[model samples]
Structures are given as structure tokens and as C-alpha cells.
Target: MTTTTAFTIAADGSYAARLAGEGDALYAERWTLAGPEAYAVPLPLAQPEEADSEVLPLADGRVLIHRRVAERHAFALLYPTGAETGPSTGELQLGGVEVREGVRVRLLPPCPAGTGAFALAAEDTVTTVWQVTGDPSGPRPVARIPGRCSGGVWLDRAGRLLALDRELEGITKAVAVDLASAGVSPLLQITEDSDDRLLLADPDSGLLLIRSDAPGTARLGWGVLGSSLPVRFPECLARTGEARPFAVQPGQSLMPETCGVALRLPEGDIGLWRPADRQVFRLAAPTGWLGGSGLWSAQGRLHLPYATPEVSCGMVGLDLPVSPPPPVVLESPTPTAPRPVPLQQAPLAGR
Candidate 1:
């Protein structure tokens, strides 16, 4: 089976980077998705990359790969040297920083601007964010956040603000890190005691998909930035076996409720939902799908990338059926003086 962990697409959905191999022979592969048809351009060096090596695609048609080499994590940009063909050769642009020993580093999600890439290096009590590329100079540390952090989500189109779930003490909360000043501020605090995480955020629409146990159990919910309205935990999102929201439709600035959300279900199926519709339409996943990887166009079409035996690079676009909007309804809260900060909205799948 193909290793799914290293598969990643660019923020703009123009390219993809993945590790394609079995057992111990793993090599980095880049897929160009902006053309009429998808094609893979292999980037294999003299030796194979480690099995656990992580790769991310940049908007400039280069692939950034992170590899662990005895006590240090190295970063580099890979690109094809000649025309795309079998046994293609690639050159590694070595300009990233070599992380210190004993530090665990991982690449964050692609920045919204698609020009820069970032990663978190966590030590004992602090995590540092590094700008690996997109700058004239070499890699440098941008932010030093207190406590261990994970789950990176860019909050602005300029890539100025990043949201990360921090774990200090025993609780976890999502906080926004301002890249300019390295300032940290609370972004989500549903309750005094809750593990809240920001799963995904759309810079265009200010729509945030969050996962938190503020409602007793961990459930997926949605909230808007700079909005006083409480977060809504619609029942349609409470599904079994890890329903992760991966892609959010762009260009829905004033209609966050109408934005298309593509979810990866437990059984590797795709779940399409919109806050206004309040229902999840299930769709079958393409074979050899890089799970939890896809992109949504403003036109309501979801493009999923996949690789199969006969076809090396392929992508499929899915269009959801249209339905009229339902009446605005709210779920009744239990009889209490103060309702939950995030009102539990009524079940939305079937109403």
C-alpha cells in the first residue's frame, strides 16, 4: 500500500507532494494539478528518503521535504532537473535550517499565501515556529510559543497570523500567534475547562471549523471570527470514527453558511456539508485517495487527487446536488438560567 502520511498538496491546490513506495523504498513525488490533466513528476535522489520523511509542496513548483538524519532534522526543496519521465532526476536546494538535536520538528500546513512554509520545533517546554522558505535569507525562527503546540491553521491571507492548539499543564486551548510581533492571544475558550482545537479556518470567509469537548464530548463545530454569536454544534457533524474537515470552499466572504465543507469519514468516504443546508451528503472516495486531502472550488466543485495502478496521477471533481434552504431553526437548550456558551443546535442531517 502507498504511504499516505507523506502525501500533501499545496495550499492553492496547484501541486502535490507525496511519498510513493512500499516497504523501505520510499521516494518523493510531485503532482502538477493546475493543468487540464494531472501528471506526476518523480523526484528521486541517489538514495531513498526515510519512511517517515514528510513532504510539502510549494506554489513555485518545488517540494519541501523534511528528513531526520541522526540527531538533526534537515529541510530542502526538491525539483526535477529534466523533462518529466521515468526515472526522472531531481536536484535538492539546500537552504533550510538544521534543527538542533533533541528537538522534534514537523511541518505546518501550507501558508495561505503559498509563498512561504513553516514548521514547529518543540522541545521540553516551548515550541518555536520557523520560516523554512519564501524569504531571501535562510530559515529563521519567527515565534517562540510557550508550552507544546500543534495543529497549525493560518488565519489571514497575508500569513501574518497562525492559530495553534497549545498544551500547557494538562489542558489544551487554541491560541492565535501573530507572526509580526510573536504575540500570543486566546482565540478559543468555549469554557473554563475544555480541550479546544482549531481544525481548519478559511481566510476568505473567516469561517473556523473547531473540535472541542466544551459540549461534554469531543464534537465538531463551527464559529466565525470577530462574531459575537456563539459557536454552533450542529448534530450533523457528530459522526462516528473521526470526521475531519479538510477543504473549505473559498470566495464565500459574506456567506459562511453557504461554503462547502469536504469531510473525510471514518470509512474513507467523503462527507459534504454546508452550515446553511445543515445536512451531510455522503460521497464515495476515489480509489487510492490520499485520505483527508482535497480542494474545493468557489463553484461548489470538490477536486480529489488520487493515484492507482493503471493511472499514476489523477483527480476527480464532484458536484453536489442543489437543495433549497430550510427555515432558520434553533435547538432548545435545557432548562437553565445560563445556556451553554456554544449553543447546541438541533440535529441537522434530517432535521
Candidate 2:
């Protein structure tokens, strides 16, 4: 039985994933708004004998399909007319991106709160970031940064700032890239002995999720950027498994939480972290499904994709209550540790 992993859930609550069944097929599943189940249907795509491809979902429900063709990457925008059926390939448009043959070119997630534009990260010697607005046929390269871009996550809600973990100067550090000014700055300086990766950050609240290995064990920590104090996971919450930052839910205050996770199980150990309480909530794996794809929804409802023992994959919905950070500091603070200094606000679109 082939296993499937949850990739990314779109801004419009649509779930896009790849099912590695007999062949690699992308599944387009419809997630009900704050409901308890998902209606998933496989997207029919022509499989090349032995090639690589990706599915990028647009905010308007159209998906851009990128596949390597004739030593070059080919792209087409797929607009599915229904959730259960696959889109017709009648209007498939080839890409206009001219790149060296066999060079790795990948698609980044779409900005849920931004102007609905997504990014294309190409890695040669250095990483080149390209922005694709409404045109998949004409994706223009935007910023170029030194070191290899591992991947980037939005630092703010507007997608103005992106934090990318790159191997620069022999150390992995989180570098912040401002989309407006094309400005790149070092946000987190990971040490030689300890490694850190930026998961997600909320500039408006200065709340950030960074995977840190300083404690001799890989753990998830929530930190307020620029604050003199340290980002701490409650001592009560033992870090056995692993967790990464998912998406930031929309909200004005903390209680529910602005951010979430897609899937956080490393060894069947599932853990949840709350910024308001600064504690990690541990949950046991559910029967029939060992793990979930990832998590997100505007309403604190978690849309999770899971694989059964039958080698089949499906989506499940969970209504989770939000947790607030602890009212009083329980864990010791790291006042002298290097803290994240906030970046300048990026200008709004058309400003």
C-alpha cells in the first residue's frame, strides 16, 4: 500500500494534495466550512513515463500545473468546474519561463492574505524568487539571495516579508525578505552548535514559531520577536515528538490562536502548542489513522488529511478550541539570548 502525505491547504479552504498511489496523482478535495468531513476526489492528470510535477492552487480556484517536459519545465493552469470531477485539459497553457535544463524550479504557497500572488523558488547556485500574479504563462523573477533557500514562509499576514532558512556562511539562519523593497535581512542567527529554522511569524503580534535545537532535543518554541525574553515551551510539555508551525488563523486577540500546523507527528507523537498559554498539549494518535497531512481553517476548525491501514487517504475535520498563552511566566526566561528585532512595515499594495 502506498502512503500519502498532506501537502498544503489553499486559502479558499480547498485541499490540494498528491496521492502516491499506483502513480503520483494530485487529489483536489473540497473541505466544508467549519464542518466535520471532506469530500475528496482525485484530479485526473496525464502521467509522464518518469517525470516530476507539482500542483499550485490559485486563490481564484484555478490550479497551475508544472511538469518537466523535454528537459524543460512545462506549466498549465487548470480550472476545475466541479469539486468531484477533474478539469478538462482543453485550455492547458504552456509556461514561458526560460531556464537552464534540469535546474530545480519549484512553486511556493500562495499568500492567503496578500494580493493572491504566489512565488516560484528556483535554485541554481543561489536561490531566485519569482512572483506569479495572475499569469502562470509569464512568471517574472523578483529577488535573488545568496546561499541555498531551503524554503520560505510568510512573516506577516500581507506576505510582504518572508523568512527563508538558508545555509549562509556555513550556518543555517533565517533571512527575512521584504517583497516590496526587495530587501533581505538576517532575522535569526542560528548558532554552530544549535540549529534553528523559521516556521512562521506574525509581525502584527510579533508571535513566531521557530524550530530550535538548542535544548539538545529538537523542539518547537514560540517567541515574541524583539522581546528581551526568550521563546519557551513549557517544561511540563516534554518534547518527545516534533511539531512545526502551520498557518496563522485570522483573529484580533489570542485565545484561539492565529497560527496552526499541518501535521506535527514525528514518531506518532502529536503535540500542540498554544501561544497564549505557552504550553504544548499532547494528543494520542487516533485509531485507523496514525497522522494527519497539515491543519488550517479561518474558524479554528482543523482540516486534517490522514491515511488508513488500507493504503487509502482521506480528510477529517476537527473542531479544536484555542489556547491562550500563560498569564504568568512559569518557565525561566532567557533575557540575554539574542532576540528577533522586528522588520519595518512593508507598504501596502498600490500605496
Candidate 3:
């Protein structure tokens, strides 16, 4: 019953938080990734958290745990107690967010600034985004978007802008939320009648990995933030069944096409590819992978974290090379070819 968002990495990539335990004894665990050897520290409270509870890592090494109690969602900060406090941990309750009986709430991805955390409270026709931390007063509502929103990706390094897939009138489109101004604008609308989602984004290169049915079927594609170029879906990505992109190499500020992408395939294998290349090289996934939990470095290195019975905490660093560009193929003009359309209607500010 582990929640899908159980594993999360801090915005700075120095720490990770996840729910780890066997059977009925689940607790919060934090991994120190900035050190030479990765290790995990358990932060178990007097009571075990339910399997469905979500944990998010903060830049300061504290974990934000979200639990559902009746019609309210409670929040708490968990940290390891100092040695003087004796081999234990401390939990500071930050209160809770109340919702209607049938509404559901979930934690959003960590903000890029690493100073605050956020979550979404969703109902039938609207979703409320809340800033859960970084304010002395307490958790407060940031924006009330007009749709059933899902999928969260930070579009900038400052964490001021967030992209969400919003479903309205039976159509899903990606939109950007300005946390500073509480404004919403279109981010991705591949077609008038199609579902488009922004799965992952790299702020350094402005590379956006997307999935859309504009090609008649949902397929993986890549687009730039401010560029008017249309999204490109390579045939190679279509060969794989529903590729789930997990990480994109950062620090390629000028070359978004060369950023390495890590994908979790449908067959339980890991695939590495780049927008410049048309091939996906597959690798065997490590055991006990908090599936889809990983980070990429500016130097084209990927770090994947996992925990198993044999090894309590471990990280795998893979230096995946950027694939060589494929040769260009000349094609004859065809009457039935689809037209190239920009994924987004307009370039967002601060891109």
C-alpha cells in the first residue's frame, strides 16, 4: 500500500526521504547523498505511519510527512535527534489542512529553491495549491486553479513557477502557476482535443519532456521552454512502451538537446537516451529501487537510490554517455504528413 510519491529527493540533491519498513511497521527514512558513501537514518516515531502516507525531503535535511486523518491531512517535520538527545528522533507537528470528505490531497514535488514545500487539495472541479513551509505563520493557500490538476514539475530554479497538468471540460493541458503572483497561464496545449502532460523538466537547459496524443497516440517528446519550435517525438521513443522519464541531466544551459534522460520502461528496465540521439540503451534496474527516484548531475552522471534487506541504504552512480547523433535521413514530400505545431501557445515569462 505504499504511495506512489513515497520516494522524493531534496531540491539540492543532497538528501532523500522515503517510507521504509516491512509489513505493518512503516517509518520515515532519510538518506544522506552529499557524503562519499550514502547511508540511511531511520526516523521512527512512537507510532508507525500508514503505508499511504507521503514523505518529502527538504534542503535542510528534515523530512515533511503527510498523513490523512479522517477529513484532514496532517503535516509534521521529522529530524534525527542529536547525540546528546540519545539515539532518537524528534517530530514537530506543523498542523494539518482540512478538506471535504471526498476530496483528496497529495504532496507536490519539492520546490527548486529548497526553502519551502507545497501540496495540492483536489476536488471535482478545482484544485487548491498550498505552501506548507517557509512561513512562520503556518501552511497557507497559494492558488486556487480551475481544474482537476495532476503532475507537478518545477519550471524554474527559483521555485516561483510550477507546471501542472490540468483537466478541464474533458481535456487535459499543461499550465504554469506563478506562486508569486498567483497567476495561471498555458504551458502546453499540443492540440485542441488531446491530453498533454509535462512529465519532467530541466531548468538549466529548459528541456521539457512531454507526453501527448497529438500524434494520434500518446508518445514521448521533447520541447524547449521559450523556443517556438514544435515538440519532436523521435521514432526511437515510440519503440518503447510508455516510457516514463525520471531524470534529465542538468547544467546544459545552452544545449538542451544533449541532456541525458533516464527512463523507467514498462518492462521493469531502465533506459537512457538523449534528444540528439534516437536510440534508448536499456539497463537492468537494481533491486528495491524506490522506482522513479533518482537525480542527475551537471556532469552527465545519474544517482539512483535503493534499499533492500541485504543493504539498508545504497546509491548507484551511472555515468551514461551522450549518444552520438544519428545520421539525417532525407524523406520525400508526402501529402499526409502531420503539420508541426508548437507545444505551448506562448513562451512563459522568466524562461
Candidate lDDT scores, in order, read 0.80, 0.54, 0.82
lDDT of 2 by residue, 44-120 (tens): 54643122466555555555566666656555665545434634432356454666664567767657562355555
Clashes of each: 0, 12, 0
- Provide the lowest-lDDT 10-residue window in model 2: 342-351
- Candidate 1 per-residue lDDT, tens place, 1-351, comes to 666654688888899889887677788889999999999987888798888788899999988898777776778888877555655566655565565677788999888788688989987689999998867676789999999898998887778889998998989988889898999988888776778889998776667899987777889998876555667787789863479999999877756777788899988899998877757889889997875689898898999988788887889999965657763533322222211133223233432
**Best-to-worst lDDT order:** 3, 1, 2
Worst 10 residues of 1 by lDDT: 331-340
lDDT by residue (tens digit), candidate 3, 1-351: 333235789888989998877777889999889989988898998898898899998999999999999888999899998777687888888878989987879999988898689999888899999998877777899999998999999988888888988999999998998888888988887668878899998877778899988777788988877666767778899998787999889877757777889999999888998887879999888887885778989888888887767867889888885566763322211222121223543222232
Best by lDDT: 3
Better of 1 and 3 by lDDT: 3
Give the higher-lDDT candidate: 2 or 3: 3
Better of 2 and 3 by TM-score: 3
* Candidates' RMSD to native: 5.9, 7.8, 6.6
